[model samples]
Target: MIDAEITFRKLEIFLCYMQEETISRAANQLGISSVSVHRALHSLEEGMRCPLFTHKGRNLVPLPQAHRLAEHATEVLSKMHQGIDETRQIAGIGQGRVRIGTLYSLTLDTVPKLLMGLKLRRSELEVDLTMGSNSDLLHQLEHQKLHAILISVTDSDVDQHQYEVLPLFEDDIFLAAPKLSTLSDRHSVDLRSLKNEHFVSLNEGFATYHGFQEAFKIAGFAPKIVTRVNDIFSMVNLVQAGVGYTLLPGRLIHAYRDSIRILSLSSDYQMRQTIALVYAHNQQLDPNLLALVAEGRMYARRRSEKR
Candidate 1:
């Protein structure tokens, strides 16, 4: 008993109502008469056999059911757009390439592994990968320069309405020091013990930089920052040379463990980084990007299962 007559027009009206929050406002935005807007909603309600809104004096407030419907409506519309784009591509009128963005820290392994996974499946797929800071990547995504991004959820403030997010992994920050250091001999490094320690950190806009700032805040003292570098690998190089200790994610430490010792923080000082794959929710997903997403999901699952 599904509603076969639920037209795209009706769904568009529904989404417009969700955005504008009123019949008149929705109507105004759609450039349609108030009566037509009302009729469309009424028809949709009849088709679904459910009320999407509740009247409150002069205002029409969306019910919880309406919010739920909005999610479906968005997916339906997005899929419809994808269908059209795919149709055009199949007709030999459109290009097929996926532009992916990532933060600098992922360059060491995650991005390369993902690209390898993507290329292994489809050698014909064209993949364009760009690396930047977290905010820079998000900005590129917003400007349509990139179709997808991988970033730390703890450091990103992405708008959920505009993007689909897939959480990847839980990474904890570790204090990275020289391999033969006294701090490495500790069972757990106390943050207060390093009040006067020199620190090497990534410049602002990096997720690790924010994590570094958070660790200091928890320690209740400003770290004696010796130098702010642009990338985590460079900071690792600095730490290995005994220039200073730096905070880094477990992944980075795991990669360079032979050269550095990553110490765990004591109680009330541990913070975690949640990495995620984000892409535009409203666009037609490119086939290659779709493959990358699938691989990323599988990678996340395996990583989670191992832990």
Candidate 2:
């Protein structure tokens, strides 16, 4: 039997404090004051009528009871998040909302066209777009935080067995440098020739990052990276400012064509990014998701034919 005084917040505070090992760290993680964290933790212990932790100077050491409680707390929080997702999915289905994740780069061109085509098929369909790096989107999809995601399977690391991947389009990576630069003006350049050049790169979570790593390895020299940006837009901006050069996909060439020049690398340096829609096979298919998947397959066929 549990009292009404015990609540989810108390449980959440308990978990946070347990993981953080200090009241201050827990307070920071929860975005609450230390006093509030202390109060919540104390209230939780009082409600359960057990001591979950013992103070060791500034740190709180969890007892065996706390460890047991933590396992149940994690399950409760996960189920709560899943329940919220289910409720939203049901509510949005009637109003035509589909939760779709996408890479930051696709938001420029591919996503818009996909959504427009989807609207043509189902006028009431509304796409709720979530944009992030390739890895982050996949994680959200796995956790049921999103219905589907569009990511580049450029790296062989995309686990096909875990996700139902529908190939969308292919894009090639090219060296991007400031306009009128020597590499840009050259008919073609060996990748190794630019081994010593300062480079701007996307951080490791992106498929492009892995592509760059592979390309550099093939060239037999490590690039002197000027800096790494999480977003492609910022990476392009850095290249535009003459900070350094970078590798970017063909789909984005038209956007930065004026400020930056894309150079054709030797065959050995060529890398392709395959854009795809991925989802857990176990997910429930809604009408909107079905329509969007159909539109993506149609769009891919049209794109391939043109190529």
Candidate 3:
């Protein structure tokens, strides 16, 4: 076992002295006094419990043990540096990968556009995506399982003190039904008129679920619910099969244009979702997150311009 007194710093100074072949020159290379260099070498020799040098008049001559120690010390320091770099990469620091979470519905447009833009800006960066409900994503982000999340902030109680939020865009919720439904001909849907309709809804904790509840509250009656699904795609599938009516965000319209009919909500029950990128405030300066924030800003600008 090595003595605790023999430190990485001492090893570094020893290596420099071995290369420079003189105390004054090693000190010059390391920006320290010659006495400090000599003292470090002496302390290192004492820690090793072996003679590393022989004094030849004013010069210190390296023994064979010193040469062997230098070789091993170089390998140890190199490995240490490699380990630190790998750890930092895995932590999403300094040009490392970023893990992003989003709602299943965003996969159709918002997520694709943002990720594509991110790729263009950071070609070497690795992006991992996990899709879930708004609440699940927020929970994962809070637990440090995700580097950032793209989600609806309007429905979530996002603590401003804990997170940095960058608003992406507002999505209007529309009444969605089977393609051939009679409601397709209507310009706008009033929730009160649909009180007798059986609806399929997303489960609680989803962003859209809050909107669903709010719209019904304004209508003053709860519509019969056929079922509650966990994901938007499943809800859309049920709607397409004519199981029941559902609400959808405008961003998902293009993906099911032929399978479902989307109509604007009447002013009395109109609901809009504000989507944003959310991450821990402490990680605001991380390089991977910085890239994500820049990409989010660009995406928001493009969405605004298109509107």
Candidate 4:
């Protein structure tokens, strides 16, 4: 029977040392100290009850037995990883396909760029996209209906203990109106000044809607609501058709620059949205989610560089 002291971690260190041919190099690869590597190898040999290495002029060289153990160790580690992947799949934790949820507003650029990056990183990954309001997305994520979600963290109650969050970017909210509207020439709009104006808004669950509520609450009075929509694109259309003014994040500015007017909110009513990628804390180790997180970080870096 194998010794109980023999461990997968010891095998990993042994294999690294075998390939690198030096304790220091192996330690560097494993992110451990050289002493730790030496101790682990010595312990491994003791567990095996054989001489796996021979000292030669300040260097420890692998013997023939070590070479044979290396082959078996490599196979063992490979099989162990395969078993983990298979188990995760059977448990429905690490499926080949990833279900991603996002806010409707993000589909304009942020979501597309990240998805493209993810596809490039994982060619065999099957992706399913769902778009909804912030509250809706978070609800789906909490219930495990979505593998991950991209949504605004600001004003949305995300429990940090339950989710792993990666912030992508910060976007300022702006007052949106028709291009030829009377308010178009203004550098910025005060929510207090529009207390009597008719406005279109997203329904209660959206992050933008939360901002809308806060901005108006700060203004101390509610504006007349002309209509309520579920998505930002529809609200943008209503604003362009001169239906009513609405608040939107800065991300959509360039897309509607020609048709809609986007003005900065006054200091008193200014709101910023923090968009992030969020997944279950337990799913952080899932390979597909790992790729998604990496892509999100890359996207965030590129976005910051452009600023």
lDDT of 4 by residue, 75-158 (tens): 999999999988887645767799999999999999889889998998888999999988889999988889999998953378
Clashes of each: 0, 0, 0, 0
Candidate 1 lDDT, tens digit per residue, 129-238? 88888888888889878888999975238888788888888888888888767865657787778988788988998888887888788889999999998777888999
lDDT of every model, 2 decimals: 0.83, 0.84, 0.89, 0.90
TM per candidate: 0.69, 0.67, 0.71, 0.78
Candidate number achieving the greatest lDDT relative to the actual structure: 4
Clashing pairs in 1: none
Error of 4 at 211 (Å): 0.3
Query: What is the full ranking by lDDT, best candidate first?
Result: 4, 3, 2, 1
The TM-score, computed over Cα atoms with residue i paired to residue i, of candidate 1 is: 0.69
Model 1 alpha-carbon miss at residue 102, Å: 1.3
TM-score between model 4 and native: 0.78
TM-score of 3: 0.71
User: Tens-digit lDDT track for model 3 on 1-307?
Assistant: 9898799999999999999999999999999999999999999999999999999988899999999999999999999989977886776566547899999988888888888888888888888899999989999998888999989995347998899999999999999988768874657888888888889999998999999999999999987998999999999999999999988888888888888888889899887899999999988988778878998998889889997
Candidate 1, poorest ten consecutive residues by summed lDDT: 88-97
Identify the runs in model 2 with alpha carbons over 4 angstroms from their true place: 1-95, 154-156, 184-186
